[model samples]
Target chain A: MNVPLLNVSGATRRFGGLVAVNEVSFEIGPGQVCGLIGPNGAGKSTMFDLITGVRPLSSGSIHFMGRDVTQEPAHSRSPMGMSRTFQIVRLFPGMSVLENVLMGFQPKFPDGVIRSLFGIGRLGGQERDARQRAYEILDFVGLADRAGDRIDELTLGQLRLVDIGRAMAASPRFLMLDEPAAGLNDAETNNLAEMLARLKADGLSMLLVEHDIDFIMNACDKIVVMDRGTKIADDIPARVRTNDAVIAAYIGKRAHDAQH
Target chain B: MPLATKRASVWPVVAVLALGVALPFLLSGGFQLRIAMLIWIFAILSMGFNLLYGYTGQISMGQQGFYAVGAYAFALLQIKLGLSPVLAFAGAVAICAVLGLIVAYPLLRLRTHYLAMATLGFGLILNGVANRWIDFTGGTAGLTVPPLTWGGEALGRTGIYYVVLAIAGVVFLLHDFIARSHVGRALQAIRDDETAAAALGVPVRRYKLRIFVLAAAIAAVAGCCFSVVSLRVDPSLGEFHILVSMLTIAVVGGLGTRFGPLIGAAIVTILPQLLLQFGAAETLIYGAFIVLFLLFIPHGLAGLVENVRWTRKSAAPARTAATNVLEVKG
Candidate 1:
């Protein structure tokens, strides 16, 4: 009954002659928490890159909120309510944690150099608003207390949350997280799952790419399994778990496994 | 209390500016004033370098090329065209900024060490041009400018010192503002993680080119001032002499920290003259000090200050566990 928030049709990426992602198609509806699971070299991260404008698609159509954004630059797409985090945490190590989040708010600031320099007109107000929002996002992610600390001081798990807070600071309608639970412990993983659920409740759409099966199973409403850059299965979690292609892809019983 | 903190951060700058104003009187010699003026000029150049290298994380070896362009631009305008010093300085800055945009377009594409090498090659080309263009640059012999004067009075060594001091103060304030502004944050983001910053919607290449041009323009301003003070400009200004490009004043003082370049400039500029006071062994001692500084304190004196702050803060926790526990509980 709801319009899809993100629509990817016949997305194909080729690195030289080798096809990395081949005609993959999927749709993510509004407020949907979708899971994308694939083994190493399954082109999941590359797909995130393509969707976020980090990599130019060889051939594809990516529509966000019914608008074609296939050729938009990363910065432009960010303000259109699309934001993503890296597989490896990429906080500004030299800057304070709050400032790292503030970096994500770059798009909301006045783009005029004169306004930025003179701190006049709309820019000053935007800066104050951005700072307030950054702090609030940090608070939401339970990182308000650590805002003043340098990013390098935080542990890997804390840094992951900081990365999420940074994406949230952009006020994105859809958040793409790549391996958000990659380096976290059990307790931290559980906390992250809870946080993702809370964010979903707040009407935020999420595309989660993670290796932790249990975490994904608990958090995602629907699952899209990728194997060798192809969509192996797409269904609700209960149906996807019993799908043969998904099973073979995860358990290494596929013809594609022999080529590697 | 926050205002008090802000005031505390500002006082050091006020004190340093005051010291700069009083330096000529304290030294009281023509040679000393000359050396001080050179230090101030180089300090400005180092600050420009700091913006590109320290803050933006772009290693630029072509700064010397820009410096020569500025120096020659100022020199020719003053000597041949008989332009006023202020007009010549402005023309020099304008030309350098244009050159910066031209060079940065291609050079910004080169990554890391390759970028450094590309800029180095560009510097060499500029140096060669200066040497070969005999009529304009005076070849290896160089060109000279008439002494700078204001209000129908020639600026003596002491007067030049004050002028240099004033220029340095303005440049320092400009640098401070740029460093604290959104532009500074964007530059730092580009340095920290270019891909991530780009993903967050930073116009990485545009910001990089902007800073590159800004740095060049600032260097041109400094170069113009240096040419006027020395009354001479040479092809050596563009020579790409590794040491001149590697003048680690910013690194030796503190990269990315305000006033660090001045400290670096003072050490590099003043040390040789002080060594001159000691006769021929000065060069040997100078080289040794540089080697030692590079090896032992790579972060420069600024790092040492940071180290001291770190130790003091680290030590406080050990001595006040009870207070810390109470605060944590509260």
Candidate 2:
């Protein structure tokens, strides 16, 4: 499979007696827009956390770019071109959007604390470059006008876009988005889907967790369905739509009537 | 969006600097000059405290530990090792920075109240060591500091005041730069949301430690200056009362605002003198003001200014935005 961009195997997590995610495994090939969809509390977000190293798996492992990174910290993964956004829309509210994007770009530089303090580390030159990159990312996300705005000034949709902008600012090879469309309106969702299409055209791989089924159905090249933390189906959207287990677990019994 | 586009005003900062410059001239009496010098010394300490507590949102009640370390380290290096005072001060700052880095690793793992308690314990331990280490520290009696000299000539009061002013000026500029730099943004990001900051590749723990060390070094320098001013380094330098007062200065001035520490230091330092007519009731009144500030102006005086500025343009957006920012649990 040309060494999938992200590889997960036997991933499991338990909170006491509850098996939050149970032996789920999946992969996303290069340039693929993969959607992870399931009923609420089906461990979709937990899977994202595990892959990004925000949480440890009870068993199993995650490999990114052909290297085992299950034991690596979340911060360490970013410089290796891995980035993800929170389901809760976390932004540094006191900071402007530009400053938030600047943080995403900072890890790429090898500036040490002493160098940063002394301003010899291009507080002038590198900062200019960072500012330029931040502006470009903001423009790409259609937020160039509000680059100076605080998080408190953004709408829910704008906040989600800002999150995406921040995630992309790292120039990651892989992006994992958790419920990016939860509170976005239809127009906003369409805007997001368009951005995802643009990103896919640029040959970036994505694993998106969204409850917006139609958006997922239309936007994803491949869909993975999960039920009770296990992968119930993984295939092209067309085939996954008709898979009996996927329909039963996610699309409902009425979906079986239509399939028959 | 109201006034979000406006640059934070610089006039207030300039005015404060002007007031500081005018202080020595405004107060001619030696007693009042000593009071003014104490204010300046505390202002330095409070500014260092703000770097950790205000900007990074870490509550540390152990700053006096660093202060005491700076005083003793400087004194011992000068008197015992016979080093020059300047070199000793630098050594003391280095010592405090190293200690801050060491302590931060285990202590910073705790959050909020737990962190506060841990830092309080750290201060207590340092104070205890100062009290019991009679051979090295002279215990409760402490060590007398000689007047800072240049080429065997003692730097008189004027020279010393200028020296303090110059060091404080450098510290202020250093702090201002950090606040505006990418490092500052990273620290603020960590403060706002540590997990998110980490996901964004902020290296959260390292940033916290760096700030802690930097703040500690600044506090230590302030302590060196305090010893010079007092002509002694007593075990009481590391006492919990110093921690409480430094915290009160930061809180009363405004937690995260620029120039807050100076304002807070001035108020806390001067207020006690103002209340001397009330005799023993001075502590009670001072405590009452702290309570009043906390209850009525939770954001401190700086927050009050921000609120006023926020409301001047459009109260609606400002009101909602204030609540949204405050709603952040951490």
TM-score of each prediction: 0.89, 0.87
lDDT of 1 by residue, B67-104 (tens): 88999999998888888888998899999999999999
| Each prediction's DockQ against the real complex | 0.26, 0.37
The window of 10 residues in a row where model 1 chain B has the poorest summed lDDT is B1-10
Query: What tens-digit string does per-residue lDDT give for candidate 1 at A1-260?
Result: 36689999999999888788889999999999999988888888778888888788999899999899999988788788998898778776556777788888988775534457666455556767777888898889898877777665688889999999988888899999999999899999988998999999999999999899889988898988888888888889889888877787778886465334
What TM-score does structure 1 among the candidates reach? 0.89
Q: Candidate 1 lDDT (Cα, whole model)? A: 0.79
lDDT of each: 0.79, 0.80
Q: Give the clashing residue pairs of candidate 1, or none.
A: A75-B201
Compare the candidates by DockQ and give the number of the best one.
2
Clashes of 1: 1
